[model samples]
Target: MILIINCGSSSLKYQLYTPDLAQVVASGMIAKIGEPEGYIDHFVGHRGEHHRCPVPNHRAAFALMMEYLQSPEYHVIECPRAITAIGHRAVHGGSVFFGSVLVDDAVMKALHECASYAPLHNPCNIIGIEEAQRMFPGTPNVVVFDTAFHQTIPARAHMYALPYELTQEHGIRRYGFHGTSCRYVSQRAADLLNRPIESLSMVVCHLGNGVTMDAVKGGQSIDTSIGFGTFGGVPMGTRAGDFDPAIIFHLVKDRGMSLEEVEEICYKKSGLLGLSGLSNDMREVSEAAAKGNARCQLAVDVFVYHIRKTIGAYAAAMGGLDALVFTAGIGENSAEIRAKVCEGLGFLGVEIDPRANEIARKGHPNISAISARAATLVVPTDEEKMIAIDTVQLTMAQPGAASVQMGHAPSTHGVAAS
Candidate 1:
């Protein structure tokens, strides 16, 4: 089995998949880690077990996860050795790692150096990798980066307008986020359209709590919405996107506010939450808007406006649009948001069938109108599966990896199991 681990700041989600990637054998989540009371929800087949206990850290979380996976009540695996390989979802690889690679001493050191790029995330991801290494002993682990798919972004689009020397020295460039989700959805869109991915130009809108608008042309990311940071794209649940740097100057220099205070406001106290003064969830904002709340209406308008504008800009960048794909929470479930985003996009040969858009969540992938020139699709992204595919490919291609294919541990040349 292949184990996929996604470690967030305060949560760890995992899925156990077969080597063939055909089915998920087990899955669970350890939430609110490092808190006074943490929650564990584990599922094997259709049976689920939940617990609320004191979880101090990621190591403790990993211990509990293994315990639950092997418990008699839900024995998904006989032992740790049952897991043939492990795949990790790493948020930021920076420029150090352009693709998923086996973890080694040098990779660990590079991950430490790249921690500053994603302070809250990379440390936790590193911890998960460490715990897996220690617990699963000789199992090979592969890391799939969220930023790796965007490494193809050209210099013209990724470079900022700052001084060339200073920017180069500081490693300041657009390293897009949500690459994993975009990659999965874009390729899924091509499959749904029955076309070759290398011949199609599409824009993938990953609209979740963290949003990303990526222009994928000829199976490569030409440009993306997120830049140097995760909050540079379209407005997200709590993130202020594409704001003027002058606002920071005004708050810090003129109003005498600390940079930390301004940063908090930009990252935590802004976006739909700040604008609506209600909640960060789009469902709540849309509910309020329907009830005639002016601020909620404004919030919805701003969010949709930014999405529409970015779609237009990406279409221009790709020269033409063959498909527009939407995925993630908001993109997949909210029909109202999808309609509003497509309302002003008719000029780009984009149109959605109203009934199809409404029922998209019911497994209708394509919502494009019969008369539309470009296809609009709602693809449910499976990032864990994507990571698993990469893990299987890379691990099997390593030297002396035939042992792994036969459900045995890998050799030293393929992975350092010691």
Candidate 2:
């Protein structure tokens, strides 16, 4: 069994995959960690139908996951011994790791050092790693970085127009997020298109509670919508997105709002929730807009406008795009949002068939349209599976890895245990 861990600020999601069986034996999530009313929701099998219970910390949450997976109800395996390796989804690898690596002392230290770039993510991620190390001693752990995949971005695309000293001293530049999703969906798109990924150019849209559009040319990121921080590009659940820096001074100096107060507006008091004066959920926004709520309509409009504009920008960035992919929550399920975003891309040779967009929800091989110059696809992102694949491949490549217990199972794709 391969365990994959994704640690967020207030949540920890995990999945146990039995490669030989080609199934997710167990999966769960702990929500509101560090909060008074934290809870764990664990499920066995592919359906993920299970229970929710109080879980306080990362260690406690992990223990809960382990207990349930090993319980007679789930019956994942006999013990931790059945689990060969652990895979971690690390958010910001900085410029250090261009690919996955077997976690060692040096790699752990590097992850800690890179926490400055991702204050909200890397710290918690490290905590999970440290706890897992203590709990599953000697087990091979692999760190699959979210930013590592985008390390191929060219200097001209990642660099800012700043002083040489500042750029070199601070390491300030564009390092896009949602790279795992982008990598997975792009590869899926390549498969759907029946072409070599290395020979294709595509623009991938990762729209969830957070949004980012990436320009992938010949299987490598050339440019992306996000910047130095994860808080740019299109507006998201709570992020302001593409706001003028000058507005900060105006709020602090003229309006007399404190820095913290101003920061809240940008990070928490904006986006669909703020604009619509309703829920942050796109489904709710769509419902309100359907009821002719003007503010909700405006919020949805602005969101789609930015998505379309970024799609155009990426198209131009990659010279021309061969395909446009939509993934994540909003992109995959919301036919309304998908259609609005692709409304005026005919000039770029992209068009979405209304019926196709509506039917392309759930599962793979959802092609919205193929006749357009650039095919528009809705491919679901599988970051956990990607992490597991990376972990298995990298850990088994090490020196003395021949003895590593890889569960002797086939992966979801029927690949044998490494």
Candidate 3:
């Protein structure tokens, strides 16, 4: 079996798959760690069980996960030895890891050094790996980085216009995120179209809470919306994306506001929340807009405008667009937003069937109109399956490794739309 672990600051989400990645054996989550009361929700097949307890930390959570997987009540696995390999979702690998890697002493050292890049996430990921090493001894652990797929971006796109010496000294350059999602969605789009990924020039819009627009050309990322930081992409739930830096200087220097306060406003008090003066969720904003709320309408318009603008820019960058992929929360579910984004892209030969768009989540994911030149697809991303695939491939390359049959595409059994 291959186990995939994704650790947040106070929670862990895990999935277990057979070595071949054809089926998901089990999946669950441990939430509210380090709190007085924590929750564990585990599932085997269609049945689920929930528990409430005082889970002190991630270590305790992992122990409970093991118990649930091996106990007579739910014997998803016989023992720790049943797991052939482990895969972890690491948020930021900085510039050190260009792709998924098998864990080792040197890799651990580098992971620690890169912790400065994502102080809120990488440390938790490191802890998860360390605990897995102690609990599942001798089992190879593979790390699939969220930023790895964008490492193919060239220097011209990744570099900032700042001073060469300053940027080089500080390692300040664009490292686009949501790479794992883009990689999966891009490949899945090709599969759905029955075409080779190498012949496709596509733009993948990952419009979740944290948004990223990736320009994938010939199976490699040429450029992306996100820059040196996560908040530099399209405006997200609470992030103020692509804002003027001069505003920051004016706030701190002229308005006498502290840098910390300005930073908080930029990261936590902006985006849909700031623009709509309501909920950060797109569903709620759309509802309010439908009810004739001016601010909410403005928020929706701004969001759609940015998405459409980015698509046009990427099409120009790639010479022409062959496919436009929509994945993640808002991208997959919101038909209105999809229509609005494609409304102005007629020049690019982009068109969508309204009936197909409405039924996208009902198993008809391709919404492109018959007259359109570019294909538009709503491909649900499977990051965990991607991680599991990487784990199986890396572990199977080892000497004396057991051979396992592999599947051609990722299974969508346990994955939800978001």
Candidate 4:
């Protein structure tokens, strides 16, 4: 068994997969963490069980999940060590660790060093690493970075036109996020197009609570919208996204605001929520907009406008666009946003079949019109599976590697056999 874990600030999502990563034996999510009554939804096959219990912290949550997994009803594994490895999703690798790496004290130190870059995410990720190591001692664990895939971005595109020594000395450069998702979906798009990945030029819009767009050429990320941090892309649920550098100065000098206060506003109180003076959720914003809320409608327009403009820019950057893909939360579910974004993009030969887009929220392969020049698709990103695959491959490459065998270890092959 290979268990994949993705940890957010207050949530943990997990799935147990067969050694080959072919079948998901069990899956569950722990949400609303640190609450008095956190919720858990567990699944096996088509059956599910929901429970609301006190999960004050990630440690408690992981313990409860372990208890459930070890119980008879959910004992898909005969023993703990039968599970070969635990693959964790580490958010920011920066320049220190380019790709997925096996977890160790040194690796953990590196993650801590890079924590300053992703303050909102890396701490929680590190928590998952600590708890998983404590719970599954000696079990090989891997860190699949969200920034690793974007390392392919060339210097000319990634560098700012600022002082040469500043960026070099401070390590200040465009290190893109959502690289993992970009990698999975772009390749998936290539597969769907029935073309070689290196031959496809595509743009991927990862719209979610955090939004990012990538210009992927030859199966590698050449340019991406979000840079240096998650707040560099399109206006997301809470983030203000790519704003003018002068705004901070204006706020500080003229508006009598501190830099910290400005940061707080741009990162948390802006974007859809700040613009609409309403909820950050698109569903709610769309509803309010439909009911003639001008601010909410404006918020929607702003969101759509940025995406449309970016698609044009990135398509130009990649020379020409062959495929356009949407993934992540809002991308996978929002038909209205997708349609609105493609409105003025018809000049780029983009066309959407209204009915196809409406029914394609669950990662449907094609939402473009039959006669459209370029392909439009929604590929639900499988970062967990990617994590699992990398874990299996990297661990197997280590010399003298062995699975931690339990007393009741089955004869069946583990993830390494894959």
Q: What lDDT would each prediction earn against the true structure?
A: 0.88, 0.81, 0.88, 0.84
Residue pairs clashing, model 1:
none
| Clash number for each model | 0, 3, 0, 0
Quote model 2's TM-score: 0.92
Q: What TM-score would you give candidate 1 relative to the actual structure?
A: 0.95
lDDT of 4 at 131: 91
The better candidate by lDDT, 1 or 4, is: 1
Q: Residue-wise lDDT of candidate 1 within 215-285, one digit each (tens)?
A: 99999998999998878879899999998899999999999999999988988988899899998999999
Instruction: Name the runs in model 3 displaced over 4 angstroms.
Output: 398-418
- Cα lDDT tens digits for candidate 3, 230-329: 7887888889899889999999999999999998988888889889999789999999999999999999999999999999999998999999999999
What's the C-alpha lDDT at position 391 in model 2?
A: 84
RMSD of each: 6.1, 6.7, 6.5, 7.3
Please report how far candidate 4 places residue 235 from its true position, in Å.
0.5
**Ten contiguous residues minimizing lDDT sum, candidate 1:** 406-415
| lDDT (10s digit) by residue, model 4, range 23-55 | 999889999899777999888889898999888
Model 2, 147-264: lDDT tens digits are 8667777777777677755555566777888888888889989998899999888989999889888899888887887787877889888787888889999989999999999878
TM-score, candidate 3, is 0.94
Clashing pairs in 2: 19-410, 20-409, 20-410
